[model samples]
Target: MIRPATREEYPHLVDIWLRASRQAHPFIDEACWRARADDMALRRLPACEVQVLEAGRRVIGFYAMHDDHLEALFVDPEVQSFGHGSGLMAHAMTGHSSITLWVYSRNVRAVSFYRRLGFSIVDEREDPETGEPESLMAWSR
Candidate 1:
C-alpha cells in the first residue's frame, strides 16, 4: 500500500534511499551514500513531501518531492522490480503539469527508469556535488 509517510517512517525512507542509491550506482563508492544518510534522515526527509510503500508495516520504497520536482525515488534493493518504482511514478504524476528531476548520467538504471516513465532529458550538466555528469529530465502532463 502507498500513503503519506508518518514522522516515524522518515527513517525508513532514508534507509530505502541509501540502499537503492547504492544498488543503482555501484560505480559510486558505498561510503558516499553512507555519508549522506545522516543528512537525508535529519534534514531532507523532514523538509520534503514523502510517500512510502509498505508491505504489512514494513517500508519497502519511497519517493520525495518538492513542489513539482522529484527529489528522490527509491525502493529497497531486496524488493525491486515488483512495481514499487512505477507505482511511485504514477502517484507523482497526478495533479501536476509536469515533474522534473536530475539523475547522474552514468546511473543508467535511474535514467532508464525515469525514461520508461515518460521523463525525457531536457538539459545536461555536471553535478556540483560530485562533479559528475548528470541530466535534467522532465515529464509533462
Candidate 2:
C-alpha cells in the first residue's frame, strides 16, 4: 500500500540514500555521498507529503513530488526490480498530466527505468557544480 511517511522516516530514508551510494558515477569519491546526504537532509519538503511504498506496516520504498515534478524516488535494494519503483512512479502520476526529472548520465539503471516509463530525454546538460553530465527527461500523460 502507498501512504504518507512520518518524520521518523528521515533516518531510514537517509540510510537508503547511503545504500544507493552505488548510484554515483564510477571513480567518484565518498565526498559525493556525503554531499548528497547533506543536501538531501537539509532539503525542505512539505510536511506529511512524502509517499511511502509500504507492505502492511513496513516501508519498502519512498517517493516525493514537488508540484508535477518527481523530486525523489528510492526503493530498498532488496526490493528493487520488483516493481516497487514503477508502482511509486505510477502513483505519483495519477493526478499529473506530466512529470519531469533529471537523471545523472552515469546512472544507467535510472536512465533505463525512466525510459521504460515513457520519459524521453528532453535535454542534456552538464551539472554546474560537479560538471557531471545529466539528462532531463519528461513524461506526458
For each candidate in turn, the TM-score is 0.94, 0.88
Worst 10 residues of 1 by lDDT: 10-19
**lDDT of the candidates, in the order given:** 0.87, 0.79
| Model 1 lDDT tens row, 21-134 | 888887788888898998898888888899888888788988889898988989899989888889888988885789999999999878998999889999999977677899
- Candidate 1 matches the true fold with a TM-score of 0.94
lDDT of 2 by residue, 1-141 (tens): 998877778778777756665554554566777777756756734432588888868788888777777777888777778898999999988868999888888888889999999999999999886788889999997
lDDT for residue 91 in candidate 2, whole number 0-100: 90
For model 1, what is the C-alpha lDDT against the true structure?
0.87
